[model samples]
Target: MLEIKELRAGYGEAEILKGISLTVKPGEIHGIMGPNGHGKSTMSKILIGHPAYTVTGGGVTFNGKNLLEMPPEKRALEGMFLAYQYPVEIPGVNNAEFLRMAYNEKRKHEKLEPVDPLDFDELLNAKMKFLNMDSRFKERAVNEGFSGGEKKKNEILQMALLEPKVAILDEIDSGLDIDALKVVAEGVNKLAGPGNSLLIITHYPRILQYIKPHHVHVLIRGNIVRSGGMDLAEELETTGYDSYLKGK
Candidate 1:
């Protein structure tokens, strides 16, 4: 479980998240809907300990541990995963190798032995097959020449391999086609269970159509303005964010 309270963070001297608070309990899927540049991604970055942003106030805890105290790699080892809005391309790194390295690091964190390459291959292949991805993906450089959909799929693949306790998907729906969206969403749904939680941040409700979040939140101007069930997302689809933006 993850708990964020009165979190105030921003880049440099400009503040973006103004005392926002949210809690993600185990087995729950929470959708955070908001317009662009209004702190949705900022929240994700801060949660994962992105150094560019400074936490001027508030606190975050993961499974009762102080999350803000952990470094980014420590955060990942602690089961905090962020699927970025724009997944960076690491041209020189083999996709499979990078994945294996990351997966093994987590194992090492758990005081488990690293898996053999052959065994890891079997594991990676099974995950890729479930995502409907081709085996050739293993040979390609990480997101180097992948399409937008492929990059998003790769992010999901990482999620599957890591099995984080809490996964924060920052704009996972961005740049995905309908087919890609379905595949990605289905993969995500398959990974959800009673032991893990998801925080899906997006501007639109289309992905929620497939993921079916347990709770929906409307964020505007760096703060969560409303929280409800799927009905709030349905209403957002029809009325848009005009009502929330009127006074701002």
Candidate 2:
């Protein structure tokens, strides 16, 4: 469970999130829909503690712990995961090695023994299979020479392996085809269970078909202007944000 109260954050000289607050309860999926420049991406970045955006006001708490004070790595250690919109291609590090280090860090924090390379490989293989990733990708450099769909699937694989308590996906469907989208959605649904939650920040609605969200929030001009059930997505698809834009 995560609670954000009166959060105001933004890039240098530009305040994007204007006192926005939303709560993600356990086992629920919350969809965020908004037009460009509405601060949806900014909200995701700030939630994950990107250095570019400063939290000028308000507080973000996870399971009653203040998240605003934690660094990005600490945030990950606290069971917060973000599927970035544009995952970069890292050429030097093998995918398996990269994930193993990350997994061990999480384990280390929990006072659990880190998995050996062989054990880590077996665990990563299961997640790779869940995402239908090719065996060759395990040896390949992280995101290097991967197609858009492959990169997205790899991100999902990380999610499955990490099993964050609260996952934030920013523009996950971007550049994904129909088949890839379904795969990603299914991975999310499979990982999301009792005591786990997902926050999907996207401009499109098609991904909702695979992972039906319990609630949807409309963000505009750094504020959540409308909060409703899934039907709110349909209204936005048909009517556009002209009325909502004007009302604001």
Candidate 3:
């Protein structure tokens, strides 16, 4: 339900994405594989309307609406979610309160009434349980003092609560241990269905092993060099990106 065409964007005067194009259909899981600084995360940031980057060219549409026109909060309200590579720690905000506020805002966007805190607590507890997270996490500040895995899990927890139509996970696999990866992947798998889509961006194929993307793409030097099925990821494991990087 997301379409990006000839998309070009970068920080300040340097462009990192050059004519990148891709489509994410409903219920599809697309994996974006690439080395560091090759525009994978840049693509995610642009999609989520990060203000630091400017769109110098091309267009992005979500469910037939002009995504580039929407502000970051509007993007989130419109079902665009980005699980950050490094989830920031908000030391003063209560984790549960922050989540409830966000959830309520989405509800308000839909002209629905905000949920009662008690009701929200029940819902949050259920989601945390599914992710195998401790209830004490709700009491702490957001991502404050959390381990790498915990921060990543918190991101997934947000995803679960929001249930966005298209979730762009930017390096969600980074800093996660094997056990944490499995839990996070399992949560993603559980969330996947016919109504939602996922764009998973990562440098390695380990996360792809669990997520099982319907399509795999190799993005290098600001462009997508190749697109294929899961086999591409398997090949990448053995062959690496040397062949693709040769002339680029």
Candidate 4:
């Protein structure tokens, strides 16, 4: 449901993503594995309209809408979610309150009435149970005092609640232990279904073992040099990105 063509973007005076192109069809999970400093994360930020990067060329369309023209908040309300590699902390903001506001905002976009707090608590509780998170998390401030693994789990919880049509998870496996990684991967797998798509970017392919991708892409120097099925990830796991850099 997301189409990106010749997408070029970067900070002023320096371009990181040069002629990057990829497509994620509804219900399909796509994996992007690349070395550090490649345009994988840059392309993700640009897709969500992060102001630091300017779109110098190319275009992105989501579900037939011109995604580039929409602001970040609007893009999110339109069912685009990005789970950051480093989730930020929001002190003094109740986690449940933050999520309720975000969920209500999306509800407004869908022309539905806001959910009452009691109902919201119930819904949040259900999602928390699915992620194997304790209800105490809903009482604490967002990401504040959470361990590295906890922060990553919180990001996945947000993804579960938002239920974005096209979810871009940037390095969700980073800093996670094997147990935490499996839990996070299970959450993602549970969310995959019709009318939803996922773009999972990572440096390692271990996460793919839990959540199998329909397609795998190798991005090097801002271009997607190789595209194949899950076997590509297994190959990269054994061979690394060295061979992919040749002739690029």
Candidate with the larger TM-score of 3 and 4: 3
Question: If scored against the real structure, what TM-score would every candidate get?
Answer: 0.99, 0.97, 0.99, 0.98
lDDT of 4: 0.92
The 10-residue segment of model 1 with minimum total lDDT is 239-248
Q: Which sections of candidate 4 miss by over 4 Å?
A: none
lDDT of 3 by residue, 158-215 (tens): 9999999999888888899898999999999999999999999999998999999999
**Ranked candidates (lDDT, high to low):** 3, 1, 4, 2
Q: For residues 1-248, write the lDDT of model 2, one tens digit per residue.
A: 89999999989999999999999999999999988899999998998899989999999999889998999999998999999888889999999999999999999999999999999988888888888778998889999999888888888888888889999888899999998898899888899898899999888877877788999999999999989998998787788888988884
Error of 2 at 2 (Å): 0.5
Superposed Cα RMSD, model 1 = 0.7
lDDT of 1 by residue, 1-248 (tens): 89999999999999999999999999999999988888999999999999999999999999999999999999999999999889999999999999999999999999999999999999999999999999989999999999988999999999999999999998898899898899999999999999999999999998899999999998898899999999999999999998899976
Error of 2 at 230 (Å): 0.8
In candidate 1, stretches whose alpha carbon ends up further than 4 angstroms from where it belongs are none
Clashes of 4: 0
Clashing pairs in 2: none
132 Cα displacement, candidate 2 (Å): 1.1
- Give the Cα error of residue 7 in candidate 3, in Å: 0.4
**Relative to the true structure, how large is the alpha-carbon lDDT of every model?**
0.95, 0.90, 0.95, 0.92
Clash totals for all models, in order? 0, 0, 0, 0
lDDT of 4 by residue, 197-244 (tens): 999999999888888999999889988999999999999989999987
The per-residue C-alpha lDDT of model 3 at residue 74 equals 97
